[model samples]
Target: MASDQPARRATIHDVAKLAQASTAAVSRVLRDAYGVSDDMAARVKAAMKELDYRPHASARGMRGKTYTIGIVHPDLRNTFFPDIFSAVAEVILPTSRQIMMATSEWTSTEDVFAAMHDRRIEGMIVVAPHISENKLVEAARQAPLVLTHRHSYSTAYDTIVSDDDAGAELVVRHLAELGHKYIVHLGPANGRLATQLSFVTAKRARAYRNAMESLGLGKFAEVAGCPHYTFEDGYRAAHEVLTRSRRPTAIFAGTDNVAFGVIQAAYDLGIELPRQLSLVGYDNTGTGGLGPLSLTSVDQNPHEIGTLAAKMLLSRMDGRESVERASITPQLVVRRTTAEPFE
Candidate 1:
């Protein structure tokens, strides 16, 4: 009638000993593998129930699958990816799957891939990767793969991308609507175009150029050179663009962070925002809504993007091969940073 104390630190051997069976029999029962008789399995199950024994993960990994997914991102400090990750976690909450993560830091892709391999992840989601198309295809051979904000030229793995081109067009149209004829687009460096990564920054640059041409301001549209999306990069680019003899009446930035830098540069040079220069940015980060900045920008909806990418990855992992890519439409979030050109 007395309650039995919980077995301390349950192990496979302890379960086998309690069940009066071999270690192999206990493992077979735990895994529900073939060849174990009903009575034998029942005995082992009863022992495990009594002992509260759980199989070691390393041991479980040996058989075949672990139901784990890996995610590699280029930067974690940025709010965009963190928002996306939160969305992904929401989607994954109901599933038995687990996620492992790594950051690339614009360094060796091999190191990140190796880290994932060491964990024996069954699938992967790589965001804005720096690896080559051929290398991505090769990497996919190790696991089912999903790409976010990047594309694979191999057509082997599933990809989900925000419509950067469409987003760029929308930005240009917004500037035109604000009655600004002279606009400059501070763009990512040429290396972005040459890289084999699916999330090519040049795609947005091209969109910026096309939008200007379509609006009949091609002659006035110039792309300022920025090697990276940092505050200093934006500040320098904005300074050069603003100081020109024929200064741009308006400026569009590729990212919110870059726009912040541009705004700072404008203040440093004693230029009034929107009154002297209509500034717009992409990514729609929190700063866009600040009382001081009020930056008009495009909302890429990183949460929705991350959710779609996670769903795409899960579908592929669950054996749904046909759903290779998911495209989420973007919207322009208009705010105070844009206005009619000053006299």
Candidate 2:
């Protein structure tokens, strides 16, 4: 039901002419670059809307003005990335580029690459499970690349990651501070590539052990269920914890959604949070601050993570460096979910 008359893709001159301005000014409005007045920008946008002027994809390819960046997330079903993605877009506004997204959902990287390649994205930001070093290098060979939540395995791209080891330690230390004698860690399921990392799930496990030993409560440190980063996974794990004879006094989930589900499970069992048992989770994904949940968690700052990753990718595309890496420290956010161990 659409016209095939070349689709009449609007050009910068069209918008400029309609707005009674120069093409450079219109370009500035489109790029959100330096020195465009608010009135000018509004007029340009209005003209663009009136003309139904979509920037031509092929023309953009000609000028390398695709003005688009692809972000590969874990899954959109989880609310985590929406917030982060919005933040990244906000930061990119000044740079005049738009954001696009893809998700692996723990799916195959080959599938991710095929989709990205077919789309002809100018550059990409991949946040995948533990991917092979060679596979990531190959993907970078195709386009400019930046990785989120994973470390750089090769010099082909940049990496933006959080201090997950310290994050794990924070959870255990919080439980120790609350006088918890026994603590159980609910981590990612073993199937994903992330779980196989020397520095991710493995690092968290090691950090938990170190923290427990430091508190002289190593015997109480137990690795419980491996949930697949979901509320339902957390819910099921909570049931297992509740059934334990010497149940952990506190539970630490690797992510916030998982913690939310654990809280729900505890409520259903008539267990009092922070009373009969304390709860803690990672990734302060807004949900932790809800009045009912108020989950104590580690702030992985996903928005900051996204913003930083985009900057890294852009820098690489600009030929700033061959390989660069950055790390963010995760902070503990204390709320109502954790309390002193009850007698």
Candidate 3:
């Protein structure tokens, strides 16, 4: 039998047309607005039911909802962070949520937070933010927040991290097992004059020093300051360390980026990796696995880190108020870059 109704399903506009009411009136009825009259409300409801029309919660709110989540990271170009971002995106997709990224660098900080505050985002994920934990906690009062790599212990927000100290110990133990005692930990600058601004790196360096001393190699424990996480700083530090009269048998780089710089310096100095110099990096970022580099490193499994952060954020958004803190124990990925020291 031929039907009189249109082939396509009814829409809000169709309901408005059939009920002889303005779209605003229909909107008012849907929102239970004060001014909508009895006749108008009844007409809108009848039309909606006749057409089996459903209202989307996102479409109508006192302030309106955007159904968006904001993600803020310090450096968008860093290889390690992107893997986390990819994992977060995959988790968000099934929920019909849109993911917006913010770089805490430059003017983007203002733009990103403005979106978080003004764009009506239900929640946010921040990685290695430069801001203090208290400031972050203050911000969390306004919205649900999940922080990664920021040393957050606030009961007001969620935090997830790969245990940096333990990860460092794993590296030191691995090197020790491989018969390397002359291990030099290359990271932030060393000594009373040394300064390391990020707690994550500072913790790793401390663990490295502690591990070395505990291994009865305290006299040989050396910390080379790279000034920063930048590759050039790493290269310069490595150059200084490797070009010495007594070079380290192994190097535990603070992070993979630093390791990349160290690797370059090794090549420039005509040193063979795992032959003349055994080296390892932290943060088994995706790029480190691509065969040519196949870096022996500590695996935080950024994908897992991101997934945990996302789950916590979503759960927090669902009105669970208790603070959730999670730590993923790290693993050592043995690759081409490490080997036993030749006698």
Candidate 4:
């Protein structure tokens, strides 16, 4: 006769017993708690494998640690973001903590933050958040928070950013040195508000103007506003400027993605790159290095930024209270797209 009872599920106690370790040790192993030895971890993992043990996430959350880190970003379509994500993943690989990503593509940033909170994420890394400073500070109070690409000052959270001013200066000076007097900047629409806000786009735009003025080309300096950082906005802005009676000899795109659009627009308009018009973009994304594209860009060291953000988040999670602000220097990579304007 067969019994009607369901099979028993393995518990932490079972794992501890099988591994000849205490329940506390098993718990620490499960949490990836500090001071855990490799030998102990190996024994516990072996026991867990043999018993097919799986820890309940909800139960772990009840104890105040979910062993999960949340990453909140505006869009996943941006290639530069993936570099940061990969670097973060590599840093967190040796730990038991896992990553949970949430994008503001379909939902609001508030909703995404709420969902991450509901899941009890131990730490959070917010990339270029569009939320207000007050809301961001409030979220930081709820969990360990690290911000990337945002320059707002906050004592409650850590920040990792690139030197946007230096990056913009590099692009402007590079173009100016190439004997291009008429230079146009294509940046986010809100860049005009740089005087009021610390937004990255605004900073870059302001820096570009300052550089152009210092180089005695302020009269010819122009900025064409893009609705967003997408390729469509870039294309639209480029097309508008390119068709003008007094066209710029060079275009400084705010981002690599936008630069790609500028390239396509140039192709459609029969403007020969480097020969007729020069171009420079920010964010040295991998695709910009293609043999045909050969986009000149500013390298913000996104991988290093990502690594720093992860480490800071972990430090905050481990009870570090002091806020950290890390800024990475940008480098200009000159490619084939930029040259002296043809006579």
For residues 1-343, what per-residue lDDT tens digits would candidate 1 score against the true structure? 7769864688888988999999988766665566989899888888877887666667658777765778899876556677788888888743535678889876677789878987888888888777777778888777778888764545578888888889989999988987888888887646655232355477778888889999998988778886566677899999988887778889888888788889998998888988999888888887677877888888888888878878877767667756476776788988888889999
Best by TM-score: 4
lDDT of 2 at 313: 78
Which sequence of candidate numbers ranks them by TM-score, best first? Answer: 4, 2, 1, 3
Model 4: ten consecutive residues of lowest lDDT = 189-198
Worst 10 residues of 3 by lDDT: 189-198
Candidate 3 lDDT over residue span 92-139, tens digit each: 854546787878766544456666787677788988776655678777
**Pairs with steric clashes in candidate 2:** 130-193, 130-194
Candidate number with greatest lDDT: 4
How displaced is residue 165 in candidate 2, in Å? 1.1
Error of 4 at 18 (Å): 7.3
**True-vs-predicted CA distance for residue 53, candidate 2, Å:** 3.4
Instruction: For residues 268-310, write the lDDT of model 2, one tens digit per residue.
Output: 9888988998998877877678897888988888888888877
The C-alpha TM-scores of every prediction are 0.80, 0.87, 0.79, 0.91
* Backbone collision tally, model 4: 0
Score each candidate by Cα lDDT. 0.80, 0.78, 0.82, 0.90
* Model 1 alpha-carbon drift over 4 Å, by segment: 1-56, 151-153, 192-198
